[model samples]
Target: MTANTLVNSKLVCVALNDKAQLAALEGTFNEAPYKKPPTQPVLYYKPRNTWSVDGAEVEWAKDFDGNDVAEMVVGASLGVVIGKETCRVSAADALDYVGGYTVVADYSLPEQSYYRPDIKGKCLDTSAPVGPEIVAADKVATPDSLSVAIKVNGEQKSAFDLANMERSIAELISTISRIMTLQPGEIIAVGFAGDRVAVAKGDKVEASIEGVGTLTNTLGGA
Candidate 1:
C-alpha cells in the first residue's frame, strides 16, 4: 500500500460541505444547468494514480478545462481511513468502521464551476499527497473540531476549522455509505472550507492538523 493506504483503496473527497463554500457557489448552482444546490453529499475522487507520498516532489497540475489554469489550490484536509466494509450504516455507529485518520493535501486546478470536474486537472499524478502517518480513530476524539492549516514557503496561506463542516464525520460516513460501500483502506477526505490560496510551481506546501500529523510537498516537474 502506498503511503500507508490499504490495498485497492480509493480517495473520496466531499465538496460544498461548508457554509462558506456553499454560499460561494450558491449563485452558480441556482443558475442554468442546476436550479438548486445539491441536497446530498457532493462527492469526488482522487484515484490511485493521483496519490502522492508525504515529502514527495509533486508535478504541477494541468488545465484540462482549457482555462490554462494559472494556479492551483492546496486544500488542507483530514482524511478518514476506513477499517472495514461499510454500507447503509448509522451515524451513531460510523466511527466503529473507521480505522484511523491521516493528513491529506488535496491539490487541484481551481474549479470555475462545480458542475463537471476537469479530469486531468483533478486526477493528475502526484496531485493528492496523503499521510505522514495514521493516528488511530480512538486517538482523534474530535475529528470534526480540528484545525487545518496550509503554508506556502513557510508563510501561512490558508486556515480553516473542521467545525465549519456542514456534515460531521459521522454524518458523512453514514450518508456516503448509503450510496457506495467504503472498503478497507479507502479514505474519506472530509473537505475544506472558505477560500483557498493559489499556489505556483516550486512552492513548498505544508498541510497540518495539530495532533494528527503534517504532510509536506513541493510543486515541481512538468
Candidate 2:
C-alpha cells in the first residue's frame, strides 16, 4: 500500500479525493489578495515519492544547504478515488464518478505560502501517508457537509467544518473537469488551515473526518 515517485517531476500524481481538492481551492480563492474567485478550477499534483503507507514512520531529514529547515504539517485530508472519466459533469452527477473515499495524511513542509513555489518541501519521500480503508462514495451522502480535525498525541490541533469551505465540491469538480479529464483512481487532496506546527520523531499524528474516520501515523528522525 505504498507508492513512490521521483523528486520535482510533474508526471507523478497523488490520489486526492474530490472534497479535499475543493477545500484547498476554496482556501486559495478566498485568501487571494485580489478577492476574486477563480473562473477556472485549480489543481496541484504531488509526486509519487510522497506516498507513505498507514502506520509507516515519517523521517525528518536534516537541514541541508539550499533546504530550509522548518516544521511540516501532518495534514489529514479526505481522498476520493475517481471511478470514471468525468468532464464538466453536473453536481448531481458528481458522486457517480467517485469510486470511493479514503483517509490521507498530506505531510507539508511548506517552504512558502501558497503563492510561492514549494516543490522540494512538499514532494519529499514519505510526505503523503494514505490508507486505513476506502469507503464508498455512497456511504457518505453529503461529502461537503462533513467535519474534519487533526490531533497530535490526542490533543486537538486543528478543526473545521466542511461548510467553512468557500467553494462547493460540485463546483470544484465541474470546474476542474473543464480544464482536464478526471480519471478513475486519481486523487484530489483538500488543503489545510492555519500555520502548521513542527512534528518531531515519536510524535503521533491523527487526522479525522466525521464520516470518513481517522488516519494515524508516527514521525521519525532521519
Candidate 3:
C-alpha cells in the first residue's frame, strides 16, 4: 500500500528496541520503583490524528509557539506492514505474515520523558509521516542492516544503522503477535537508534533507505 492508504491503517510505535535508545533509558528503567528492565517492548499510541503522508505539510503544535519552522524531533524508522491477521506467530514464521517494509518518520516535541505516556509530545496531528512505497519483503536483501540517514535542509543531521536493534524485526513481530492480533494494513514501526534529528520549520527532511526509497517532508506553516 501507499502512504495515502496509511491513513486507513493503525499505528503504535515500539521504543527502546534499539541498543542506543535502550542504553539511554537503561538507568531510568533500572532505577525505577520496579527496578528491572522490561521483558516486553515499550509501546505508545500513534492515533489516527497523527497520521500523515509523504510530502505532507503539517501544522505546528501549540508547543512550537505557533511557528511551523522550529526544531522538532524526528525519528526515522522502518515500518512493518502486517500482511494478514496474525496472533501467536513464531519468529521463524513471522516473515510469512509481513506485507512489506516502508520508511516511517515519527515526529514529536523535544524533552519526551520515558517515565510516562508522551501523548502530548507524540500524538499530534500529522506527527506520523509514512511514505515513499512499501518494498516487498523478498525485495530487501538486508532488512536487519538497512541504514537510514536523516538530512535537514540537505545537511546530514544523523544516520542510524538498523543493525543495532535489540530485537530482530521478525522477533518483534512474533512477540507482538502473541499478545494481540494485528490486522492487514496495520503498522508496527520498528525502533530507531541514536538521538532524534532536530528539524526547523522550512527544513527539508529526507529519510532514505538506499534500495527501499526515501520519505521526504518539508516543515511549513499553515
Candidates in order, TM-scores: namely: 0.92, 0.78, 0.90
lDDT of 1 by residue, 8-114 (tens): 46889887787788887788888878789899888889888888788888777655574445778778789999999999999999999999999878788776667
* Candidate with the greatest TM-score versus the true structure: 1
Candidate 2: where is the Cα deviation over 4 Å? 1-42, 66-68
Clashes of each: 0, 11, 2
Which model is ahead, 1 or 2, in terms of TM-score?
1
Worst 10 residues of 1 by lDDT: 1-10
In candidate 3, what are the lDDT values of residues 77-151, reduced to their tens digit?
A: 888888889899999999899888888888888745677788878877887888778888789867888988888
Q: How accurate is candidate 2 locally (lDDT)?
A: 0.63
Those runs of model 1 whose alpha carbons end farther than 4 Å from true positions after fitting are 1-8, 63-69
Q: After TM-score superposition, what is the CA distance of residue 56 in candidate 3 from its true location, in Å?
A: 0.8
What tens-digit string does per-residue lDDT give for candidate 2 at 8-125?
1222222223344445556565766626544443356666767766677776654668443556666565676676787889876777787777766767674354454467667777
Candidate lDDT values, in order: 0.83, 0.63, 0.79
Off by over 4 Å in 3: 1-3, 64-71
What TM-score number comes out for model 3?
Answer: 0.90
